[model samples]
Target chain A: MSAVLTKDIVKTFADVNAVDGISLAVPDGEFMVLLGPSGCGKTTFLRIICGLERQTTGDILIGGTVVNDIPPRARGVAMMFQSYGLYPHYKIRDNIAFPLRTQRVARAEIENKVEWASNLLGIGHLLDRRPRQLSGGERQRVALARALVREPTVLLLDEPLSNLDAKLRASARNEIKQFQQRVGTTTIYVTHDQVEAMGMGDRIAVIDHGRVRQVGTPTAIYDDPADRFVATFVGTPPMNLVAWNGGHLGFRPENFLPRELIDDSAVTEFSFRVDRSEYLGSERIVYGVLEGLESVQEITAKLPPAHVDQESIRPGEWHAFAVRNSALCYFDKDGKRAIRH
Target chain B: MPRPLAAAIREVSFYSAVLFFVVIAAFPFYWMVITAFKTNSDLYTLTNIPFWFNEAPTLAHIKYLFTQTLFARWLLNSLIIGVCVVAITLVTALPAGYSLARMTGRSGETLGIGIFMTYLVPPTLLFLPLSRVISMLGLQDSMWSLVLVYPTFTIPFCTWLLMGFFKAVPREIEEAAVVDGCSILGAFIKMVLPVSVPAILTVVIFTFTLTLQEFVYALTFISSSAQKTITLGVATDLVRGDIYFWGELMAGALIAAIPVAIAYNLFLDRFIAGITGGAVK
Candidate 1:
């Protein structure tokens, strides 16, 4: 097992800094995800690690050897690109065999490895087909077969599942995670999809605007985000954040419920109107402005769809909601996580 | 009139117009081919009907073309020059275009547009100084002079064409190849170049034709009969002063057109795609 490490990588294009100083370490066999929105510099960080783009200042190490001056081909890492990057003119077998051929591996060994990889990817039957002939999912597997055949110490995937349909993306995510675990290779995956990151990463690094906001296990980051950005960025319906107590108070919508539903153990309570409601089969989200500060703030509370008549939660009514103090996350002046238990 | 009659009349008139234009377009080529095979005696006769094959077709004009003049030598000179131009243009343009497309960013685009502007600089204006440069190289009568000079125009256009083509290939593919153990140059040869066949063929055909038929420089710098290209030699050597040897001239012209026509037919799909796709993409 080979660990991958980056020490303070930074990249700038023209006057705009793309990847701010970022230092990360992926333990041997760990699957780490650099999660961020587009233009947030996650891809730039991955490119820097691969030596495809020179960092303005940094040190990169794979398998304990410094690789700052190494070219991408010699860096001992393979990346599956967002585009799948199969050679359009070559068949799947040749695409998978390319890296080995470049390394001057003997023809017989190259064929063996190509076969092994295609089998591992469940794409052995598609070897004779060109990339343009394969469906998106098959093309994706071919790309993975190409990447894995090299068996580099570290594997980098840049939004590899982004092009798949939603259902296929979920399955591909599972495939990638299981594959990484089985191979036990240090893998760094980059994606803007929070769900994919949380589902596949052994640890997720939340990044925004070229900086890493927080890095931790998915559960830890979800339960205890390191900053306001992470709290809002990691969860679906994103943690509902609002101006409060001279800082920012945040609570997941699920934690905000009808006043009667919250017990005496609730730490904070508010009177807000439910002007809009969305029933999501399993639950209902009631949205409205906070009472008295109606013009200044709004809040949404999620409840079981059975709790109230659908019409009662409709627009033009006021309702009260409360939050369990434990579920609240507070960020200070600069949006850094500062809540204390 | 019944609707069927009206429709028939409209269809007939439309096809007639199409046939009229088609004949107008094809007549010269038809005339040239027949003239190439006609004897000088048959060609000069005033009483013979011109449209159909009335005389026994002879290869006399073509035979004279090969034997009486340096037409063979000129054709050979053109072939050599065309090959050199294609080689130099591809070697220089593919890498220059890739670098401009991948490395230079906004500056590369500006520089590329600037280089294309140099190609837009008419060769008629540059021939005088280029002639001086050729003479300075001690290549006053050398066909190598044309080989060296043709790229001055060929490279800029080829580079522009290739830059459009290379840029059209998504950068991720190249990056993936790099990650899969290829150096920048290795990726270019193994991946980028192979997928770029249409554009490469376009560059080859474009430069080859341009170099073969280019006359001003060939006429000005190359005075040696042996060094003149087919286009220059046939027009100058085949005619004595003012009289045109229609049979021989048409034969030479037809021969010159054959290779280009065959080349276009061979890569017709790629040629059209390269023209429309690379430029727009």
Candidate 2:
């Protein structure tokens, strides 16, 4: 296994810069996830790293070799396409063995590895079946088996779990994570699903509009977002942002506690007008517009479901909530993080 | 009329209409087969005699076709030319179609349309100048003349046909193959071509039929009896200044139609799939 590194990569399609100058360094055996919304160039970045797409200007070094000019096969990168591009014509065994066959591995060794991978993914009995005969989860396992069977320097997955159903997506996500750890193969997975990124990556790179907006551990991205976009995009119920004293203040929904929880007057407080509230089993999520703000902006506040007194709060009513100063993240007018003295 | 009887009557009329069309379509094929089996007196009764046949069903016409004439040689020439045309069309069109389907630039559709337009130009218009070029190369009066001339039509049409089929294949499958250590050409061979079996079969049948049935170029370029294809031989050699060899000619026509009919029936489903492109998905 080797660390994959990109130096100032830029990909321009005619006049549109699909991937702006972005540099990334994925350590050996690390699970690096590129996360973004659709058309955000996360897939493009992953494709460049796999050599399926060429960068207009950059160097991709896989295992310390500049692989910018090398083809994908020579680069020793095996990618599992988002659709689990299992060859429809090939049996499961052959699909998993394709990369090894291309590498000209001996027949005995190829069979041994194919068997090992199929069994590892709990799909050994499916070896004789065509991809069309298998379910989506089975196809995903076959795709993963094919990618890892060759034992490449890097494994690339493009939204691999997105095809599975919701129930399967969670389990498959964990399986992929555990599989990557077991093999200790350096993997770069691309997904538009933040929960996948949050749950799967050793570190996540949040991408937007052909640029890396933030790269950090999942907890850091959740707790200390670099800017307003990351603050709002990375959290569930999303982070609430409002203009306060000429600065944009960002706070997580969970960080907005009932007024009794905060004893300090120095903390930021909001008279949140409750527009609606949802009772999730663990948390009571209250969504509303903050009172006394000239410009209209909505906010969400999370409370313990045990403490959700149904008689005390209702829709179109104002509620007292306070945000601890430490919990407040400030961003400048341009949405860049602001450090207050 | 009562409702049930009226419904039955409608069904009967519908079947009769279908039967009428079927008879109109099938009568000529029946006439060819019956003529091939008829004795000399049976054919002389008249060309228009309805349900015509004689008491005797003779194999004499078939015997004359195989023994008395160079019909076998003409059949072999046609077979050789048809196979060569298919091979050449495949060699040129598969790659050209792949390139057209996978082309990244804006001109891909334009170039594809331009190539298809060449197929629309009448072969009758081309044979005039093509025969001169054929004789210039000293390939005149040989089956090679037709072999060389046929792909000029086949390649363009096959390329256009296969382009649509190749485009129907998902780009991700090829990209996946590329990442699995296949070169672009390797991806096309191992993945694209195998997935395109139906379209390839369609192209084979089309090129086979075209070269076999093409009469103008074959007759115009090759005047020697030894070099004549089946179509040219049946139409020209069997008619000696309007003295038609009715039985032998029909026998030759019947034999030629058999292989094409069998091939179509064998690949009818696949041919439909190739045109519709819904087999795999």
Q: What level of docking quality does candidate 2 show? A: high
lDDT of 2 by residue, B1-281 (tens): 89999999999999999999999999999989998998888778765464666557899999998998889999999999999899999999999988988874558778988999999999889998998899899997888988899999999999988988988899889998999989999999999999999999999999999998898888789899999999999889889996999999999999999999999999999998887773245
Regions more than 4 Å wrong, model 2: A263-266, A294-297, B1-10, B46-49, B278-281
Best by lDDT: 2
Give the best candidate by TM-score.
2
How many steric overlaps does candidate 2 have?
A: 0
What TM-score does model 2 achieve against the real structure? 0.96
Candidate 2 overall lDDT versus native? 0.89
Candidate 2's DockQ is 0.83
Candidate DockQ values, in order, are: 0.81, 0.83
lDDT of 1 by residue, A1-341 (tens): 34888888889898788988898888888999999989999998999998888999878888899999999999889988998888998888999999998899999999999999988889999989899999999999998888889798888899999899999988988998899888887899999998988899999998898988888999999999998888888877778777766678788888887778876674688777777888889988777777644222357777788876686566887766788898888888688888562
Q: What are the per-residue Cα lDDT tens digits for candidate 1 across B1-281?
A: 99999999999999999999999998999999999998777788889888776789999999999988889898999999999899999999999999999998999999999999999898889999998899889999888999989999999999998998898887777888888788788889988998889999999999999998899888888888998999999888878888999989999999999989999999999988777755675
Question: How far in Å is the alpha carbon of B230 misplaced in model 1?
Answer: 1.1
